[model samples]
Target chain A: MTTIDSPPPPTLRADSLQAIGVEDMGVRYDLRFTKKTTIRRSVGQILGRGSQEPFWALRHVSLRVVHGESLAVIGPNGAGKSTLLQVLAGIIRPSEGAVDVRGHVSGLLTLGAGFDRELSGRDNILLGGAFLGLEDEVTRRLLPSIIEYAELGDFIDAPIKTYSSGMRARLGFAIATSVDPDILLLDEVLATGDANFRAKSKARVIEIVRAAKAVVLVTHDMSWVTEYSNRAVLIEKGRLIMEGDPAEVVALHRQHTDEARAASAAAATAAGLDPGIAGQGRR
Target chain B: MSVTSEVPAAFRNAADDPGAARLIREGLADIVSRRRLVRYLVQADMRKRGADTILGNFWWVLDPLLQMLVYVIFVTIVVSRKTPDYPLFIFAAILPWKWFTTSVVDATSAVASQDRLIKQIQFPKLVLPVATTTAGVVGFAFGLIPLAGLMLFYADRISPFLLLVPLIAVVQYVFTLAFSILLAAGNVFFRDLGNVARHVLRLWWFLSPGLYSLAVLDEVHVVQANPILKVIANANPFAILFEAYRKVIYGAPTSPPGLPDWTSLAVLLLVSVGFLALSTVVFKRLEPSFAKVL
Candidate 1:
């Protein structure tokens, strides 16, 4: 057989008392190999072994979710919304702090994360199932319902690349929700697909959200934050800024955005720049 | 029913660098527990490689046969070497060499290429290299059909020592696996590694006994006079492995098919297992950063 890090060690463990727990968690990313600066700094390093700057994608964030709870995380772009979900999903181990998660976690963290575009939906389903460490037979038993939910019909046999973006999202949602794990983590996915598909999926999401012991959703849609979650937390600049009723959290996030825009607009006006353009800049 | 990490902050970060014992336990445990993922990934890999092609699986059979012929013509006509049953002799080295090169090359990018998958899901990153390397075994298995045909065609070269093929392969597997883990993790931190690996592997093939066995190397004064070069030549695992393949497949120009060098095989096994443990430690140490870097 072939053979196959880190310390604070981000500590994410499982405890029976809580569905998920994070204590002083943080994830630092190296700027050199990051998507934006990767090319420039990588070349710089090759030319003259330069020191790499580390960006704290998340910092001093602690959160907890208990069984029978649904928590929504909302934030603007690059606010580490997905990063928080990634930590909860155990895809990322924090550089600092500890986390405990109680049971099996299944998620469609990113719409296209686990899919192989060249494989048929059938193959990708099995592939995704295998990613969750399920055997072929166990995945096969769940196939019919996944297909029905995805509504791929004959397209289930076609390569995933040929499926519309909506179909892809549907298939992803189906797989994540199908396994009935104790906890479900979803990332910016509920807003996908056509209206009819969305309507049908809302019911499925509700069913899953209610059935699973705990559910964590990351989305930009304010409506979804309130409509889907009983408890919500707002994230901004990698910090948990607020946590409360979903509607109140969503409202506060909106107020903060508007205030940020107004402040930027005022600064623009004082500097003889266009307020409209400046308002858009911060977002 | 409630609990909190009682570990002090200083000690909490201790997990950042696991002890050797824990690293070994986790490394072995991850590979063992998630074997189904490896099998599935290997199947998916083979399916993708052969998809939508007219010849499909036939290419696996045809590829080595065609390469053997090319090498045979190059050796006999271009180099003017006269060797009988050259096809079987060369074919033996070709199969295992191909497996080693292809698996290692694949492992170099295995984890790096799954950047999105790694970031979005949680599982042992160990599975990535394990899966890619095991897929090579399947590809190598496909190459065996040609090996069988060559043996049957040259019935005179057949020997009971051929049963030792799997035994020899086991050694090669252990060695390739150790290197694959190292390469897989190293390539993530240094993107240039994959590019360098291709050229290095090609040079390695040339330096190994693929084209000429140790029997020939012993005849060279440059290699014989320099004890360091002589030891390096013997230390090349492929030197021992390729020579073993040749021994069981047909043997040197003067000798008949026979058992491989067991002493060498055993040494390779122990060294490879040690290297595998070391590679696993390195791989795991770098793993948490993979989702970050990639």
Candidate 2:
């Protein structure tokens, strides 16, 4: 038997890159306000100089996805997982760092970003496909499959505003996955859809990943991470705290949460906020 | 390069290269693609809005007709007396001026309003202003059909110079695009641009002869010190185009009863092009920040 080297040669699911590469990237978002003298910012200005300051959404976060690699970004709320995905999708700009992506990226942060509420589901699918950078010819070819996959049935001709939020998610997912983007960024998208549709969507996503060049799955679902990801990264605050086998990293994260909680409590107290504030916040 | 490095002179120098060729090729392609999406979005929006009113699409015609009637009453009854066949003159000038002013105002807020979309998409930011302006142009076109019918009844004479309507429309559209881009880009950082635009447009209207005939101001010193305003009043594409409409419809001189100075038209075109080039550079340089601020 030939000796296998280089960490099992990174499973190749496509003819092209079996992995996607991301260099040392940093993203800084300048949340520029129109200088409105709000009570909050006004107080800050009175207390300190430089009335405005930029919020760093992502700071020097970098990871690589092998063509056919599945990576899960597991983090607490506001840990910048979605921001990393947005940077990868090129939707959000990085003020300081650079991101060099190898293939097309389809992001699933909001299911309805491309859907016009006024348009019919059919029209919206075509529009969504076009918005995702699909050519008219490509959309025309994929129309039937996209509609069928959405499971929208006769409702495809009905106005999308009439569709439930779940239905919209299904439609958006179908349209996005139809193109087989080289790299996929899924941000808590699996949480949407009914049980029956959820299973189907998961199967479809699996099918996509089976053929996809790379995928970065950002979700709070630990089970999904364990089941789907070959590699897992846990980000705390703005930095990566752990990375390795999904199960081992998650176990380590669970063990370290007590320490993390203590630090957060101390920091919260220092900042004059309740220690239990974020915990009491929305899930 | 590390973020801590000093501002390198070489890199800073590259910022002033004008970047016209790269912008024309890459920027235009990106803009054209985004414009396609904008077209679809506008179509969907129009359908939704058109279906909301009780009269369905007829409101497009009625809205302008009603406005023309108001302007007619205001101009003939309240303001200018020299507007011969005042109703027809007002109707002729109303549609184009409405097109220019509304389009500019609408385009000023176009990008600012779509802050969510701009922040989430990497396509050219110019698409929003251009799309808003296009929507205004389309609305103006819809309003023109009824105006043409009014012209047939009130002002029956016709002239060949009427062909300038489309050419002048192009000039106005290009000029609006340049202004909209500048204003829209500026508004991204300065929230007061919208307010400034309203007053500026009001001032521009007074200077453009949209409500008054240029013949009334032949000897005014304001016309001498500000020839562009004077030319804007007389050969102002909006005024000149409507004057062309008046000539085609009422056998009147197309432009203040004098030969239009080709130099002014050339100058307007040059100024518009200059503003456009300037706005493109500024917009591109600022684009990296749009997704964050917007």
lDDT of 1 by residue, B10-88 (tens): 1223146677779989888888777777877888888888888999978888888898898899998899877778888
Once superposed on the true structure, which residue ranges of model 2 sit more than 4 Å away at CA?
A1-7, A10-19, A34-50, A262-283, B1-20, B33-35, B80-82, B119-121, B219-262
- In Å, residue A8's CA in model 1 sits off its true spot by 32
Among all windows of ten consecutive residues in candidate 1 chain A, which has the lowest summed lDDT? Answer: A1-10
Please report how far candidate 2 places residue B210 from its true position, in Å: 0.7
Question: What class would a CAPRI assessor give candidate 1's docking?
Answer: acceptable
State how far residue B248 of model 2 sits from its true place (Å).
Answer: 5.6
Compose the digit string of candidate 2's lDDT tens values, residues A91-149.
66555545556666666666667566778998887666556656667788889998898
The TM-score of predicted model 2 comes to 0.83
Instruction: Give each model's whole-structure lDDT.
Output: 0.81, 0.67
List the RMSD of every prediction in angstroms: 7.0, 6.8
- Model 1 gets an lDDT of 0.81
True contacts kept of each: 0.33, 0.17
lDDT, candidate 2, equals 0.67
Candidate 1 stretches with Cα past 4 Å from truth are: A1-17, A35-49, A266-283, B1-16
